[model samples]
Target: MNITRFFIQGNEACARGAIKAGCKFFAGYPITPSTEVAEDAAIILPKEGGTFIQMEDEISALGAVIGAAWAGVKGMTATSGPGFSLMQEHIGYAAMTETPLVIVDVQRGSPSTAQPTMASQSDMMQARWGSHGDYEIIALVPSSVQECFDFTVEAFNLAEKYRVPVIVLSDEIIGHMREKINIPDKVEIIARKMPEEGPETFLPYKAEPDGVSPMPPFGAGYKIHVTGLTHDERGYPDASNPETHTKLVKRLCNKILNHRGELTRVKELYTEDADIIVVSYGAPSRSAITAVKNAREKGIKAGHIKLEIVWPFPEEIIRSAAQQASDIIVAEMNLGQMVYEVERVVKSDAEVSLLPKIGGQIHRPEEFLEMIYKCQK
Candidate 1:
């Protein structure tokens, strides 16, 4: 097994990672800051004996992905805000159907074509609340190109394991920037678990003791009925029954929320004796890391939390950081989106401050350090 090194953009890296994770079907509609993901998949997937399709629109793109997932292949799609907005119905549908899939949202400026080519972390909140439901989501924010590849594979693994749609929430910079990444010859690939029960007596929606139902592939003769309607253990529509709706929805949420401890990941620096702890995700975390070091160099006890898992919010990590800091500074390329969650979790434990950047620009290390020092004061 030989390792291959490649200098490539983040979107391309993500496309390659999806293929590495055993994704056989990719359906996407091209959009700014995310089109390269579709482009690269178009080139790479067919060679791997997989299928790549450019759909009519974002809605159709995700519809195709959902179909492919049921057909027993790991499926994925990429888009920015506009396309992502269009995919919300299917996102909710995938959640309700318990379909294992991955979506790469390389976010640009939002609120309807705000900045097509610029970077922003404004979509951080949307990643959590985009779909109109109470289902839990797994969203990984990669600060660099290497993580773009790494977390794309991780997303697929999580999606298959939980049987939910996992999202890779990248920004414009990370998606477009070119960086060197080591491609492992044998990265771990996890396939969706199939039921051991025979087709003679199988109920597709029947979750195990672990609260996760195995997804048998279509044409596997399981006689399964998949739908967005409220379903029971038999996978048949049961929308009329309130108890069935409650049970199905609760299981859908509890399955991921119960596993939140393992699904969450964070990077920490100088957090033990910190007076100011900067919290960030996506590209802003890069500057947050640098600012923490710069503050430490200046004899300031500043720590940093690079939150890789943005959804399910990584509350425990923030609680840990808050235990050691006087000031919790939340920084992002937005006008305070994730700062609300940081404020909620670390309330009264640490003084929460916001270092917001808007209009598609990034905050420099020195700029964040300046804000950190001010908050320290």
Candidate 2:
């Protein structure tokens, strides 16, 4: 119940935040721009009487987190692009099993082993669809060291509340940046719900009106039969049955999609009566905000939206902003990955376009201002 100030890097902030959020377990393999998360966890978790393990690889890293969560501990893992690529199948499995876990991806540039120490928002799309399945994930973007702390806590909260993996989508810039984080007195921490009934009455995947089933961790003993195969309410593999598979998959997608109104959030500035809108997130958002302010001083009706919730995207908000603008300029540290997403939701006379800056750095504020000026033209 006391406020504190700490100047630290985003990765350290994320580690501290995970601890504050009551994360009791961390499983990870060291990767550039994100290894500090595991490093910090190693120091802090043991003090909290928690568990920290360095797995053989990124796949086992996530696997350990999943197994720990099933054992009833709040669990997390961190990695960069290459490591993230290895965790995809397990990400889908967490979604399928409705496991509560937090994953932090400090994005680097490109396909394989590209720019390990550099920054890129190239993984924004991957955060949502990296796994080879049709399921939704909650992805959060942190623009500053403070948000790195706050959003890591938020990721765990969302994961436990919704029974799904929540991704903390960071870039090397945000992960490595050192800044002051105002540690709050005490923040909210949410834990997963456990079954309230006897073992005989327990149903692992029962269809609830809310579409979330309470979980009973291992040794709590409600007939734990967790698996990757499509299962029914009873937690038995029913993959051979077409109906069971369809029901399970649809339920996984709907739980997040149906409640997106409550799940999605964004940061908006000067967007109400603007003629042009610059949509940006993560590190690029810092420049976008400054450029928007400078654009206003020059008498241009320019606004910006800093996307905080990337997946289960703030479609409603984007659609509304696009309708009120003359053009929408999407900016990011990648070659137009998120621009396509913006295009899908916008229905304005405002044409949507992308301002990409790849190869390790972020878009300069002046660079964004130039695109803003051109988009309105």
Candidate 3:
């Protein structure tokens, strides 16, 4: 596969990536930092014989995507801050119904539309635990325009591969940043595994050997019922038996956890033989990496754990890095979301501190450098 380089914005690349990933339907509202995604999709999807719908609201946008996915088309939606909140219910619905859809959240300042145009990584925790239920979510945070494109495709692949929603957790800075991105001419792509047998013999929720049930489209003659409530193997609402509830829940989580090796994706920089480790993700990781290099030049034993996949926590990687470091500092735009996860992974063995700053501004390299120096002392 030959990679081709071109200057492109992150949001534009995301739309192109989805098209390449076989996305045939796009339903979304216009929102800052993410509007480019919808704009591009509107122009490109139709040209590619795909459908693009400008829904009235974010809720409807997500609902349309879910509806399209059940119709056996690769579907997606893009939004930021408040819109992300509006789509939570549908996201939960996707979780329960096991619909394969990709959600692109080009995150902005939050709580209630704090900043529309400014960038923020505040949604890291929200993306993971926003939906009101117990289900595993796969989220990828891209640091650059290239990763923005690459991870968007991966998000769709993971969604279809696992029969769950996969979120591309991007922020305003990365979403809007124009950079030279090398998109491959021939890239590896994965599609949903459809059922081989007839619809009469199909069980929509029947667990496969990989824990992911074969997906049957809505119009595929498979009379499967999809609901938010706990369901049986045949997709009927089954809340009567506790065992049925437990099994379904286990399958939902196990589909991802049991295949963690295939789902977990991360990138590390200079973690070996480091006394201080800085954990960061998304656009903030760019500054964190710069801080690490500058700290090393000043003879500080600094390294970084840049997260590519935010959800599922990456406990083993965090624990292993924490064990090797004397201190771990979590730098994020939110006050203290990922810091809590760092503390849980490191326990009491290492000093874990929160270097959080919110309200649309990113952490500067000097800010992280100061934290490293203070931790060393």
Give me candidate 1's TM-score against the actual structure: 0.98
What is the C-alpha lDDT profile of model 3 across 1-377, one tens digit per residue? 78788898999999988988899999999989899999999999999999999999999999999999888899999999899999999888998888999999998887786789898887787788888978888999999999999999888888888888999999998999999988876556777787887888888888889888888777778878888888998889888889999999888888888887766677888899899999999888999999999999998989999989888778889899878999999988888988888898789878898888887888899999999999998
**What lDDT does model 3 reach?**
0.89
Q: Residue 233's C-alpha lDDT in candidate 2? A: 89
Q: Highest lDDT: which candidate?
A: 2
RMSD of 3: 1.2
* lDDT for each residue of candidate 2 in 1-377, tens digit (9 for 90 to 100): 78899999999999999999999999999999899999999999999999999999999999999999998899999999999999999999999999999999999987799799999998888888889989989999999999999999999999988899999998899999999889886789987887888789888899568999999889986767998998988899988999999999999999999998988789999998999999999999998899999999999999999999888888898888877897999998989888888998885556998899999998889998888878766
Candidate 1 or 3, higher lDDT? Answer: 1
TM-score of each: 0.98, 0.98, 0.97
Error of 1 at 309 (Å): 1.1
The lDDT values for all models are 0.90, 0.91, 0.89
List RMSD in Å for every model shown: 1.0, 0.9, 1.2
The Cα error of candidate 1 at residue 246, in Å, is 1.1
Clashes within 3 Å, all models in order: 0, 0, 0
